[model samples]
Target chain A: MAQKNKLQFIILGLLNQQPLTGYDLTKAFDTEIGEFWQAQHSQIYPQLKRLEEQGYITHEITISGEKLEKKLYHITAIGQTLLGSWISDGTPDLTATKDEFILKLYFIQTNRDPRLKAMVQEQLQLHTDKLTHLQQRLATVFPTKASQTANYGHYLILQHALGREDYYVNWLNQTLSALPKR
Target chain B: MAQKNKLQFIILGLLNQQPLTGYDLTKAFDTEIGEFWQAQHSQIYPQLKRLEEQGYITHEITISGEKLEKKLYHITAIGQTLLGSWISDGTPDLTATKDEFILKLYFIQTNRDPRLKAMVQEQLQLHTDKLTHLQQRLATVFPTKASQTANYGHYLILQHALGREDYYVNWLNQTLSALPKR
Candidate 1:
């Protein structure tokens, strides 16, 4: 199966923590996993529907009285069992896909356009902002719960993001010095 | 447009240098751009077909006597314009989607199984080997042609790959050190 299918298990894993409305799921992903993992509403809503169809989760119509009715989903026992199995089993051995930043840099040497250098600099700034935001968020979440087993996974992800951003900032500085003047 | 669409432009950018078969494109990607960019036969063949339909490339069928026929594609003028515009005006956004390795690590932390740690270690070794092979191939390709203008972009890609591999190795070491004893 395409690793995309693993998103199903990830959703199940999250719902295993608490029953959630679709909006609640989106909020959870943004706060918890969105630092490293992102999903579009287009991808999430369809997956939720499929999971409900497969009996992995059940949804209840929630009448909010103020807005449109919402569907809240809770993981079924089968869903928990499947998620447990997926967690225990190894992940698939798929190669990482191509990254465009590297590709643009590849063409930069040949092209030697000043715009390319600006692009790289822009990316560096964006990453720096994101990394800082993530660090702050992680600190807020982990101050008291730092040693909790559940929070450990998120801690590692934040660490990875921090490391990557530091690397990029250094690289961008070096690249700027090396770039030929327009 | 999905950044995957950019793969076609990358292919066209390379083909602008010389006409090549699908196999040649794959080899170029593996040796030169594989560090930050990757695509399988499943993706390439379909993209090539689409490019042909769009009149951006023309293919010539070569009969190799007893061997299988090869289709060598050459970028047309329209393709060159498209590629040039993509490189010049393309947004250098470095958006990356989900990563399975990180996802698996998240699951592993929850399970805390020794076998899982061992499995991650093994995967890390394989990635290291591949990175080493790619670096060697890049050295061979750019030995005397190092300072060529067009080779600059290629050099940047190699640098990204090396940096990424270093990050992965470091992560593996930290993970191993942090692993709880069985």
Candidate 2:
């Protein structure tokens, strides 16, 4: 993996927490981590090989069931140091945001477009459902104050996700209200 | 242009408002539209060629600086109909968000990590500056209720941008306070 590919470090960080198989890493990208970053199995498998070649990680062969062999990947000591440096590094300016819904909305020209009401209604429901899902994850992931404080950085991430969804839902609701009731 | 590349519609939307040279179209991506969508000159120029080939947009030759020729593109009648249908179409589920900062923050094992303070401080300043910029544009672009109502969808987009920055700034501030001071 190139130094600029943040996914390598994201994988490293996950392995820093605990050993995981390539399959486990792929699943993480599909779920919670998918909320902020994305990776395909195609990208993950190759990246894992490179990470091991670079000596940042290693894998142990194990049998899952009858004859299925799996490699449980673990971060090395140097890998932990690199992950810390990456987490602490200054972020680049101008984060890219590719919200196609907002881009499509830019062309609507007028609020009175006949499709505006349904468009806004669809988004409102989606954002509301998303907010509920994030809230549920927060409750289940860190059920008590002690649990939350123990995983303080993770707790903060969940808070930020909740804030993002809450803000999005409110914005959609206001937008829906502003449309003419035709 | 493929039916799936939304940049074509965005270029059409900008041209539908007024004719523009390729440079002007490129500038729009670098500015206002860059807030949510992005494209490089390489991407924009090739897409413009494909769009013309597809007969969705047409251009007229214009001279600038006494000797330089430029193609001022205009959306064709077919383009307008297509843009309308596209804006009216249902957006895909799960808009992608690739927030690298938030992803990196996930690896930060504790709030007490020494770099946490600087990281939050840097983000707070960036978000604050962004909020001020959005507010200024909103005031300048739609200074009157009459103008705002005239372009209601665009006005609503500005409001949403402000709300997004407002929430991000507040979250950064809260995160800053959560850190244990050295």
Candidate 3:
């Protein structure tokens, strides 16, 4: 079996929500969609071309600010079906994420690695800021039960992201305390 | 700037722990290391060759059985220094992981997507199992602070893994409960 092109489906999902220009598609990878999956312009642009060629998506030239042309891509019905099937399908592999920090930590061997305290502090600051940011998003994005129901899946995703950050923040705090005082 | 071949460093770390045959190295991924990072034989074998060429690693032929021969890999002193520097280096990137399940969830749009209940249930089961596995490992490996100190970094890694699993299991439980009763 051939490998699935995940980026193509991600683009399809976003387009299925609303027609977006190539620029808009690229921005999504740098923002919300980038939270869990990733894509680069080099990868996205080519995938867009392939998706258009496969008859899964089509684009129309739309004018921006002052007659600048942009290709706003729309998902064809075939694309919708493909995306629907994909969303409904099962995720067979739930492998571990490639976390470089954890991998580095594994090589510590002892608590006296000299750089260990600084390393842990850096991660603590990073995850602490992330937790605050996620908390703000939850407040702004949902705010109420009705707002949450308005985009149930998105709400769940934000909730999950917040949960992940919460775990990291808690872990970092614990790891920091366990380290010797400066 | 160039991207680091993380697999090479990971191989060096394992060899630094003990001289192991290629097969033993491969099994580590399937067991402990698989919890965070992954590498396939196709990738691992070639990378080992390169590491040997770079003088970061070397191998000796040893008999595993009556006539079975295997190459036991060991890290060079230079390799140990490389691993030490890498572990000490600051991790600049903390980008979001590529979690396909979360990406698929973002498309759900509504809780009544027919498959939503089953989909969430599947994950709940997987994560629940993972939590149990991690918990068991913690009990067996640590048992006491003395035992944990034997491999302090490994203990911390296991702790982080458990925390991650705990968060996932909790989220999955909440999601399952939120779904419409069938």
Candidate 4:
């Protein structure tokens, strides 16, 4: 299947939670699933339309403004079945990481200028900021005491994000200290 | 600049060490840089052709078989200068991870079938195998006594790879234990 179909399943999964318009879906991606999965407004709208056409989703038109029409999509029973099957059948491909940061690190020896240290510092700060934000979300979004099966996935994902951010910070620190002093 | 340009610089950087054909470059990516940077032959060959046209790189054609000619690319002085400038000027983008595994984990709750545990185990085993390969490379590719600046970069990159695999293992273990018994 085309990789775009994953986006379709993600949208269906999100709609299974609650009805959301295209704009709302964008916000949902930015605030919630944005950490790992992202789709542009262009991609989202088209996928939403396709899902509706396929009977996996149906939207209600609402009047948000005098001339604007808002589409609030809700998942159909078929959508739920599709999402379940997709989740069970799909496997994540373990291949190369196309991460630019890691790529930059590989080539760092080519230019050992002092500015490189500053750049590493900036990256460290970015990871630190992300770590703080994720910790906050963990506390508020999925409290430790909540043992609901639905929250289990979020809990595990949050842990992974935190682990990744911490790993970046560790690497940046090690790299900075290992760099030759100017 | 387009992201493809990054691949161009990467190829030039690799060729700075020694001359290589497109096949060698692909192998280099799969072994040395595969953990962080990856480019298929389709992308590599076109970029190499473009670099040759730009005079940043040149290729010498050699007869490989009765019916085939192989081109081995070598970096020019201009190519080295270009690579150095690109490395100094470029900064890695700090953004969301487009990791498909994390994306799958995010929605794993949608299908809480018992098989999900086995899937996580499979992922863990893959990571473990990768970690083992990276560790072996660390010993063979960059010995501890090698203090060359170039070796330093490879050493660090390998560390990052090992760190990432270890992180995956940790996350998978935590997730598995946290999951309710089937």
TM-score of chain A of each: 0.82, 0.94, 0.93, 0.87
lDDT of each: 0.73, 0.84, 0.86, 0.78
The interface RMSD values of the models, given in order, are 3.0, 1.4, 1.1, 2.8
Where does the lowest 10-residue lDDT sum fall in candidate 3 chain A? A105-114
Query: Where in model 2 is the C-alpha error above 4 Å?
Result: A1-3, B1-3
Q: Judge the docking of candidate 3 as incorrect, acceptable, medium or high.
A: medium
Clashing pairs in 2: none
Per-candidate TM-score against the hidden true structure: 0.84, 0.95, 0.94, 0.90
In model 1, chain B matches the true chain B with a TM-score of 0.75
lDDT (tens digit, per residue) of candidate 4 on A1-182: 52446788879878887899999988878888888776789989998988899999999999976968988899999999998777676464775766665666666563365667777787788788888999888878776454535656666777788888888788889878877766
**For residues A98-171, what per-residue lDDT tens digits would candidate 2 score against the true structure?**
77778777767777788888888888888889899999999999899788778777788888989998999998
How would you order the candidates by TM-score, starting with the best? 2, 3, 4, 1
Residues A61-85, model 3: lDDT tens digits: 9888998999999999999999989
lDDT of 1 by residue, B1-182 (tens): 54357789878977887898888888876656655667777788889999999999999999888888999999999998888777666454546546666765554445365556766677678767766876786667666654545677776666666676777678877867776676
Please give, for residues B92-155, the per-residue lDDT of candidate 2 as tens digits.
5665577777887787777677777888888888889999999999999999988977877778
Best by lDDT: 3
Could you give candidate 3's per-residue lDDT for residues B69-132 as a string of tens digits?
8998999999999988888788877867777888888888887778888888888888888889
Interface DockQ of each model? 0.49, 0.70, 0.74, 0.53
Candidate 3 chain B: worst-modelled 10 consecutive residues by lDDT: B1-10
Tell me the tens digit of each residue's lDDT in model 4 across B1-182: 42346788789878987899999999988788877777789989998999999999999989876969899999999999998777666454665666666666676663365767877887888788878888887777766454435555666778888888888888888777876665
